[model samples]
Target: MTQYHFISGLPRAGSTLLSALLRQNPAVRAGIVSPVGSLVAAVLKDMGPDNETSLFLDEAQRAALLRGLFDSYYGALPPGTAVFDTNRGWTGRLDLLARLFPDCRVICCVRPVPWIIDSVERLIRRNVFEVSKIFGSDVGGTAYSRAELMMAPSGLIGFPLNAMKQAMHGDHSARLLLLPYDTLAEHPQETLAAVYEFCGLPPFKHDVDDIAFDAGEFDARLGTPGLHAVRPQARREVRETILPPDLWARWEGASVWRDPAFHRRVAVGGTPGADHGTAAG
Candidate 1:
């Protein structure tokens, strides 16, 4: 089995920054999001029980094939480097993934739902000249309207948030860790400590003050240029939200996942990440 993990959580919640920082470890190989998860899901469906080819394949062969796909994708990497694949799609496939890799874990990088919305909204406004790649460049509306669209049941922001909530309530919840945005943005040392503890690897000293990552080619194609870029110095919060007061109020009560009590009830890591531990419910 390959040494691999996943970095998936809410959009605009620091997954890119986290990946950039962690890869500073010479033993770790991580970067922007990968399409491996999507490809695997598609292949598995085609090879499922209904497929005519299924008759020729046994469970062992299927497992080997799946593992082969992963190893093949990362074949160019050095033999001993650990891999961390970033994708929101992983959240929806936690059960399937657990069956495939018993020891591997899915790290969910999360933030407050409202703040998550705000961050995405700010991005939308910043790229006013170009449409976002999230909604297929077809998205157009006022800030509130776009926010509403983003929070739609199937949207980029909404779906992952919902999926993560389900994972929290699932039996494999302990296999998932809710790494808060504040923890990564503010106290990266402690945050990475917890990650190393979970992954059973010794901690690597990350240059938090001089961190640098830029997925320029990918972001340019994504129509959201600078989407995954990180500055040299780390900062606590993104710029202030651009949404009006009323629209912002609507999301204030949506961050139930931020509560310590909720973490105690759901997250494997029972500590609420930030010192500000307040819950809507």
Candidate 2:
């Protein structure tokens, strides 16, 4: 069977950056954000609306449907080439993925908790999503508006962290790789080597283009003066509201879905110090 790899993490948790870095390697062929398998199954569910019950389906039925979708989506990859799929939905389902594709490799991308929350706030101000709330959230998931619904834990990148923990404990634990967001930003080559080794791919040796932080790109704003700023710990406060009620609901409820590590940790497999990797020089 062909090998497949997934790069999963909370939104704004360096997923895109890692994907870009991985694509720079000659041994890999990453795909665009075409969530082929999951999207197809979801569309299938919508076809016969009356028979579709999102919450009522049993685990077996859901799994079967998902497996079919996976087959349809992944069966098309060109032979012998490894495909890196950077989708958040696969975070919790890594184990299931192993069952579906025994040769699959999973990478769990992590950052500090505070950084993720701050990123969400910035996205809200930029009108990325019409809502500020995330479902199953501790602070933002209160009874309010549309932004809540869209940002609801269920909607805001619904990859369950609990599922990730369970997968980590399962038989496929060796196949799963955890990556730090900060390290990838500061030393991408070292991080990329670990990923390549675990996936059974050839070593990577290339300098990637670095995009420095640009405030003007997102039209960022600072924190609120005194009131609504302190408690939520807003990083980029907004002058005017940007989130819609439904979207806010989803964003708010989506808090638990977040990985607690928003920043780099000390003893996470690799050394904390900046140990450089020579890219085949």
Candidate 3:
């Protein structure tokens, strides 16, 4: 049987890089975000009580159908391959995942909220000629306004952050492995070892110096080229904030995951004393 796992959490937080590193393992198959998570949600909606056809669908049927989605979508992979599906939505659907694949684990890539906004703004500036879909139809706005939109409850960065928070506090929190972008970039080999241990997978040497991954076409569609690109080297680049002083101050201490209490609840990369929880990252 094929073992399945997940890569989720905030945007621009090294998920693409993590996937790239993981892909180096011959037994593992991972990539940029996939459609399976959304497809699973669609399937559930159709089978839900709101649908007239749902009256005929029993629990067993629903379970089987949901399981089949993974089977079908990844059918092309060689049997026994470990599949790590990347999707920010998965963190919010842990209950469904627990039911469908109890052995599955979710790795949540995270960064300070301020930096997340800063990163998005940097991308917007880089693609000066292109108005990103990230801001929706109202792309004409100041950095402050764009930051507000991105921090709205349903906004790109906001939603994933909320979902990850919920997962961290939920019953299935142990199934999550929190991988901070800085930790992953600064100490990739050690980070990968923790990830392997969390997923119950045997260790495989990964090349951190020459990693490669990109989703240029996918990013272009969103008008944000290079959103999913990974650098050839996995190392942290220290830089000053591009955000204005006031903006930087506003979100400076917003990294709740850095709190000692939060660390006590979920496993954090490079933190040996962390809980280590009971499941995947």
User: Which candidate number maximizes lDDT?
Assistant: 3
Write the residue-wise lDDT of candidate 1 on 33-138 in tens digits. Answer: 7878878887899888779988898888877787777898998888767888888878788887787778778788877676776667666778878878776787
Q: Each candidate's TM vs. the true structure?
A: 0.89, 0.58, 0.93
Q: Candidate 2 vs candidate 3: which has greater TM-score?
A: 3
- The residue-by-residue lDDT of candidate 3 on 1-281, one tens digit each, is 89999999989888999999999998999999898988999999999879998999899899999999999999988889999999988999988899999999999998877778778888998998897998985668988999888888898888888888898889998999988888888889999998999999999999999987868889999899889888999988777667887886776565678786765354455552322111111
Best by TM-score: 3
> How well does candidate 3 match the true structure in TM-score terms?
0.93
- 164: Cα error in model 1, Å: 0.7
Superposed model 3: Cα runs more than 4 Å off: 263-267, 270-281
Number of backbone collisions per candidate, in order?
0, 56, 3
Q: What shift in Å separates residue 104 of candidate 1 from its native position after superposition?
A: 0.6
Query: For residues 42-126, could you state the per-residue lDDT of candidate 2 as single tens digits?
Result: 7546544467565566666766776666556767666676778766667566666776677788777664333344455545444
Worst 10 residues of 1 by lDDT: 272-281
Alpha-carbon runs more than 4 Å astray in model 2: 40-78, 126-159, 210-281
Ranking by TM-score: 3, 1, 2
**Native-referenced Cα lDDT, model 2:** 0.52
Best of the two (2, 3) by lDDT = 3
